[model samples]
Target: MPQIAILQMCSGIDPDANLAVIEDAAKQCAEQGALALFTPEMSLLLDRDRARARAWIESDGPSEMIDRISEIAAKQHLEIAIGSMPVATAGGKWANRSHYFRPDLAPPITYDKIHMFDVALATGEAWRESAAYEPGRAVVTVEDTPVGRLGLSICYDMRFPALYEALGNRRCDCIAVPAAFTVPTGRAHWHTLLRARAIEASAFVIAPAQVGHHADGRETFGHSLVVDPWGEVLLDMGGDASGLAFCEIDLNRIAEVRAQVPALANRRPIPKS
Candidate 1:
């Protein structure tokens, strides 16, 4: 069993400030025997000032936060699951990427977010994420951890069940869902979507999220969750402060649930013209 720590944050415009908080959280979680720590989307900076945020963003290289987290992992002998961070690409667009830093301090495994959130909500707020973020073409899974084979997904990717199905086919035992969900949509579909994915894939679902208001003046619905293979809510960190939530993972539960349910084996293709 691997002990996982999910961290919530209301990140601001400053990457250094955000990293300070994350460093402390990492130490605390490491001290508590957590093998891995998962952080939320935009864990580096959530600046409302897009231009300023871009000024500070780096492309395909190590940021100060990334370096710090890698050092933490090396020193603490911990594995880290970094949520979504905007990585500048050569095409002048950014990619929402999740990074897996192992204890060995070697090159990290990364997954670019496949889905982008571009919505005009009824609440009178609009976001066009595609303008800045490029959607990835590949689905990534990493298997070199103590926990189990891990599938990576960002916020909007959770809305697509086909992605989870693919991960299921890949025999991944756990999935990371790091999000900075809007208040309205998060309230309506957060738990439902997460639970459904867990049941469909029969994998442990770990979600760390942004809470409260950000430097961008946008509010996020927290409630970071750790769900078991049987669709049980093992831990739910409420939507208030930024902190770490802990849970122990049982790979046996994944096999146990799949043995009884057999959803993946029961799949049938739909004929299309």
Candidate 2:
């Protein structure tokens, strides 16, 4: 079984500052014997200005932040999952992408967020992610170190259980939900939703979240967590703060839980209304 670490980030507009915070957290996780470290969404820059965000986005290869983190991963010989970033893609559109970096590889495997957050919150806060990001069309499941098979997703995808069910059906033992959840939604749905996904799928749910206020005056709920296969939160950092939480995952527990309950196997197709 692999040990995992989740990094809770209160990243501002400064990319350099965010990198520094991540470096510190990664070092701590490595020292704590974490085989894989995960960061929150918008790992590099968290600016609200669409124009400024567009200016900072990169087309291909590695951005400054990615380069720095890649170097760190190689030096430490650690696997990393970067939460999300705004990357310039083809057709004059940007992608909200999550990166998975292996220590020995020059380039990381990237997964663009499939679900775009284009909705109005209960607090009258609205986000038109489609305006800035091109939606991804593929379901990504990677066989990585420490963890056997890992599935990747961004914030808004949390609301959709079908996606996770698909991942579990594909034999994903672990799922990463890197998010910048709003205060209203996070407070109400964050833990419950995460736990439900874990219980339903019988997999470990590792979520590193963005908490506190951003440069855009957007408030996010920060309670970065690592939940086990049994829906028990093993490590949780409550409130808004930049820190690292470590957990030793027992892979066998996943099989045990699934064998005991087997709800996933019992799922049936429902007729469309």
**Top TM-score: which candidate number?**
1
Global lDDT scores for all candidate models: 0.87, 0.85
Model 2 TM-score, 2 decimals: 0.94
- Model 2 lDDT at residue 44: 84
Model 2 stretches with alpha carbons more than 4 Å out: 58-62
How far out, in Å, is residue 244 in model 2?
A: 1.2
What clash pairs does model 1 have?
48-216
Q: Using Cα atoms with residue i matched to residue i, what is each candidate's TM-score against the true structure?
A: 0.96, 0.94
What are the per-model C-alpha RMSD values against the true structure? 1.4, 1.7
Q: Rate residue 31 of model 2 by lDDT.
A: 83
Error of 2 at 202 (Å): 1.2
